[model samples]
Target chain A: MVQEDYILEAEKLYVSYNEIDIVRNVNFRIRKGEFLGIVGESGSGKTTLLRALMMLKRKNNDIKGNVRFQGRELIGLDEESLRRLRGMEISMIPQNAVTAMDGTKTISSLFHETICMHRDGKIRRRDSDKLASQIMEKMRLEDTGRILKAYPFELSGGMCQRVMIAAAMINNPKLMLGDEPTSALDVTSQLQVIQELELLKSNYQVSMIMISHNLGVISRIADTIAIMYGGRFVEYGSHEDIIRHAVHPYTKALLAAVPDADGKISKGLPGLPPTFEKEMKGCPFASRCEYCIPRCRKELPEDVAISLTHRVQCFRTKELQDDIA
Target chain B: MTLLKVENLTKRFKKNGETVTAVNEISFSVEAGECLGIVGESGCGKSTAANLISRLQREDEGNIFFEGRKINGGFRLKPVGRELQMIFQNPQDSFDPRDTVLQGIMQGALSYKVYSNRELKEKALDLFSYVGLKPEYQNKKTSELSGGECQRAAVARALICEPKLLICDEATSALDVLVQAQLIDLLKKLKNDKKMAMIFITHDLPLAAAFCDRIAVMHKGRIIEIGEARKVLKSPEQEETKKLIQAVLPVR
Candidate 1:
């Protein structure tokens, strides 16, 4: 693909809340029609990174970063401009469906509002209704008319989530940001939602930046994976590279923690991640790293280039590899 | 010997003049020192069955026999609470937030009047070590500890009473992956060391397969299938169980 194919880019991003950094020096790029996965445990700043990319940080939160969409700056843009760009060029599917959608508004009303906000001219209700049915049909949503008439509370969680997806896609944004989209869903429902997302990605050619704690869910959809820890990207690579050869200790620990269906229990990492409030000088994972040396505690490890597509931040990757061999 | 026998257990809740059957005639047995895992999705009634077995809720129709003694047939039962204990999903709110870890565990033993004040304190200290908690956490309030530590405190409280059966109702669901592994290992060790029967209830089939000796698959308030962990997980006979297994991520 050509350089113009890249749709979104984050360069040396630093986001903080009330002078406390929640995401630090992060960098990544998304190509047009490509799916990128950001995986981490809770408090790992995955959500913060997504919010920062969307310029949706809370009041009093300081963001020192550059987020470019189609080679244009998005950080210093005004609310009105951002709002205009949102739902037209970019959209977001928030983590909490219950809170993201209005309980009183019918699914149809929400869809109508979203479509009208992005549409250039005064569109008629019939046109909006037609658009809503089209997107709902693409999402495999059954009983579109009934769903549009009923309130959010009357629908099941799975149906509510599907409606939210429809509402986000009704505007046909180029880029979509999903935060833990299926974390709250059951296994069957999760699979169904994932299938719908896959269908949307292929049929609409929409690029996505998905944030999830479940690596399995990420593995199924993401083309590239970025592992974050303590507000930093400890590893970044293609999904195949990261899953097969994770060089960072934190990434390895996360992979090992996933339970296998063969009934063999792998011992997970021993300690928790470092607290964000505390000042740290060296490696953030040193306290929990089993192979931590004195140098690891004294110097922060730089991002070591393992391959053209794979990179890791770890001092003992080679040593760990030799031991494993 | 069978530690507990549950036969044709059923429970129904009346909500807004409509009857919702939670557990519809599910039957299973637990052998001494065996770990039985009940796997199902939310609202599948596995937790309801756990509550019924612990006697936390009254069953509409069922028979529960503990150590060959019938206890759930409308017979006025004595203090059977000491013999069967339950560990809830959220460990943080399971106990009094103001109480220390030691105080919580000691309260369990003290409320049963099983040990004297001094003996209870001593036993609480010892149980903390068994659950991988340090002696210093004895004084730390429940709110001060992390998720895994709070769960350890909860386990210590449940085990301090020396119950013959421990029912973990999604005890590890709220924990992170690493912390969940530690808790599962700790439970395995405790079951081995104490020779206690356990009912591990969870929705994660992979976790259940790892820790359980036998598995029971439940769907819509029914135990659809039951067999050895490997057998049931490898080739589930019921269609719902098969769909659940298929939905799970394949082991790498």
Candidate 2:
């Protein structure tokens, strides 16, 4: 696809804090109205990538490489220009809605802020109120008036999450970034939230980059899947390609970890992920990988293209393929 | 025979002068050596019930019986507290920062005067091993361990008390899927070795179904349904339970 066909693209991006590279040489692209899922464990730099995209990281943090939106480099954008782009061109629905939103502010006021900011200070109270109600209605939120009047603390977690989504999508941004959107919710509420996201993606024609640890959620919604580990993408491809034929050991471990509906427990991977402070000389997963070779422990694996779309960073990719064959 | 029975257990907290019934007249029972799972959403009173059983919180009005003796009927039962212990969700907060894993477990054993100092150390090391932690981890502080290690330490502390009942309140919820599977395996091993009865409280129905012999489904502080884990989860009798089951994505 041409560059213009993609709404967002990250090319060889590197993000670091205090000179420590947290996200190393990441690359991905999100097409128009496509849902991309980034799955990884905690401290895997998934959040860091999203923060970099939103420009929400600390000012002193060093960001290297290119992040383009509609072919425009976003790394050098000024605060004013970035602010103008936010909620109009792109918006983020943060995790932990209870803390992300102001506890004292009503849901309606939060929606008003987004509308006002995105409209370049042109939104009126009457128009904002109508828009908020319409959006809330689209979300199928109950008692819209009461919800608008109630503060974040007054609503349930599920309700607060919906309100956050409404606020984020009120201006109808072209792309939406969700950071562990359903992780904080219960199973039932998680399904509802995922359904709402599907609805928004379809109705609003908005592309999404959903970051989650649950592969099950990714399987349900994501068109593309990127498995991140130790600040790098170990595998990236279509959902079918990655799920059916995961080339990376970390991705295989993740898939095995999920309990089947029959309640049969699978063998879990042993050992913990290496700490970020430790310098990785080879494959980050080599220590815990069952198929680790001596070469895997000493040499970093390069990203090897397997097919037109599938790619993986593993020395044993061919061996795994042959074993499957 | 019922190993433990909860009769109309209720707890209320006054927040801003409004009485919120956290546990609303919920009742359930567990057989000896049975693992009973309590599944619900947050603010649905599963944790409250666990706390009540562990004596971490006193219920407003209810009766909890263990071994045919009443334990939650307004009468003080310090002995019952010794027979039950709780494992919280956040393992780091459950332990003191300055305390090592051995120190934490030894403290639990020492509280009931179960073992001498040297014996406690040995027991702590053994507990660590039982939970799949290395003996070297016994001297490590909470900060030195990962989330899964910290949870193993928490389990060691709870088990060191040698309680007849263990209450795991979302003990594996904060863990990654792989770590969660390991912890569940550890719990299953411990249950088989000790034949210990447990109350596994969580919001994940599938997890509960996997770990518990029976499950109690809670909604709005009420025990909406209770039965064998497979039956209750597979063919829930209550509307709320059915909705919860349907909401979960079917695992492939």
DockQ of each: 0.50, 0.60
> Compared with the true structure, what per-residue lDDT tens digits does model 1 show for residues A26-131?
9888888999999888788988888888898698888897888988899999998888988888998877676788888887788878887888777777778889
lDDT, each prediction: 0.85, 0.85
Give the per-residue Cα lDDT of candidate 1 at A238.
94
Give the per-residue Cα lDDT of candidate 2 at A19: 82
Model 1 achieves a DockQ score of: 0.50
Candidate 2 local lDDT, residue B5 = 91
- Model 1 CA deviation exceeding 4 Å by range: A1-3, A117-127, A321-325, B14-18, B73-78, B97-110, B116-122, B134-144
Worst 10 residues of 2 chain B by lDDT: B73-82
**lDDT by residue for model 2 over A1-325, one digit each (tens)?**
4889999989999999888888989999888899999999888899999999977769668889999999889998899989888888898988899999988888778888878777865777667878999998898777888988899999888778888998888888999999998888888888888889989878888999999888888888889999999899999999888888887888987887776676556777777777776367888899999899999989989899999889999999999878767
Q: What would the per-residue lDDT of candidate 1 be over residues B37-92, giving only the tens digit for each residue? A: 99987789999999888877789998998999888855333467777888998888
What ranges in model 2 sit over 4 Å off?
B12-25, B75-77, B98-100, B134-144
Clashes of each: 0, 0
